[model samples]
Target: MDPADSHTDEIALSAEEFDAVRAALARVTSTGGGAQAHSLLAQWSALVDEVEEGYSWCAPELDNDLSCRNALAKVWPLLPSRVRAIRQPELDCIDVRYRRATIPWPDRPEEGARWWTWRVPRRLDVEAAERRDPDWPLGWEMMPFPRPASVEVVTWQYVPIRPSTKRM
Candidate 1:
């Protein structure tokens, strides 16, 4: 009996049937890799499409127009979280320089006593290099492109906030 026919009593394998089985296994592996690559490319393509669509309205001379800002904002939330992470540090560096430091509460004794001071950084520096490019989208400088694989997203959830009256 041929090796392929040894199990003929249970099942039979023809040349075409053997080839079909091989092809199915190959497809399964290919699909897995293909899906991942497709996902990554889709993300990249969407970002490029958004940038191109927003380009005409992004001239530096058009900075004062609200339409330019609104168009860019439409795509802002759809950006992948990863992209945002990559862009944040660069934005932070630029923001720190342009921000004006002011005491949050300078008057009203009670308000001043309870004031929770925090640095309110500028949204974006209009005078900066990135903002000066006419071809650049108005808020592109603040774009949150995710960092490379070195970074990961973390989430923390906790109970509701309740004010503590006890002074430490």
Candidate 2:
């Protein structure tokens, strides 16, 4: 394990990673186990019964999805088994789903809108994709899960250029 992979009591990660890691840690500590996420990493002892190593909370994106993938990997080790963190890049948000909801989350990028739509993962009981509210930021979404199961979307507002790769 990279020492960098070892998170400490000091919250040293980038803001996005820190927010994500903390939120995930909240889930683990809340589970029946008498655990506390004093550090982003629960002791390896605490994870003995968890899913295999190199696990992450989000669905793995493709090799070329750079920025978010880098941040996601850093938070992966801290996640409890069964909570999935999903990325909706176009909307500049992340969606978290705990195992309690076992449906297929949305995989499609939203379409035909002036602003990006923030879609509740289909797997979730929440509403479908809709235009983002003013509070949604540019590049982050935090879901606390179970209690107030909902997404808080943060994104950088912009219109990205869609370069056509095919020869016209």
Candidate 3:
């Protein structure tokens, strides 16, 4: 287990916990009055339990397609607005591995659209690595998981929206 890995895991876990807390808060506020706070708390706890059970096997299946995306989506709403905006709204599941590759935007070539790429780093386990590799390698101090990386965002280049003129 590398220290970097531990840190990454910590960050990811913290984010997950934060989201849970936020959801509880939102649920409480949705009721719009103090009378329902207690009931909402009970429901919130149950919801948390359900979420935990739902993701119990998430770590092991991080390499799988749907599972990985589901995990990502769990954290998606918690992400900063700008980051969330970068992703397509309709995308339900995203493969972490596939997201690491460069994605091409061929639909808007006229406006000089190019490829977009991003990499989400993997979380590391520091303690496990120490037992396996006595001497930690350079760059191992960094988080094992890839951080969100992105290419230049194409603000606007939609051909469909462009006006076409024909001789009258």
- Judging by TM-score against the true structure, name the best candidate: 1
1-168, model 3: which lDDT tens digit per residue? 422122211123256544554554354344322322223323433333333233222222323323323333344555445434433222311222233332322342322211111121222222322332332222332423422233211122234565658767
- Model 2, range 1-168, lDDT digits (tens) per residue? 533233333434556655555675454444333333332122222221121222122322211222223333444566443222222221122121112112222453443321112223222111223223443222223422221234332223356799999997
Clashing pairs in 1: 82-146, 83-144, 83-145, 83-146, 84-144, 84-145, 84-146, 86-147
Candidate 2 overall lDDT versus native: 0.31
Q: All candidates' lDDT scores? A: 0.31, 0.31, 0.31
Q: What residue runs in model 3 are displaced by over 4 Å at the alpha carbon?
A: 1-67, 78-100, 108-168
Worst 10 residues of 2 by lDDT: 90-99
On residues 1-168, what C-alpha lDDT tens digit does candidate 1 reach at each position? 332222211224456644543443334434422222223323433433433233233223223332222322333344444433443343333223222221222232423221212211112223333343433224433323322232112223345699998999
TM-score of 1: 0.20
TM-score of every prediction relative to native: 0.20, 0.19, 0.19
* Model 2, runs deviating above 4 Å: 1-11, 31-42, 45-168
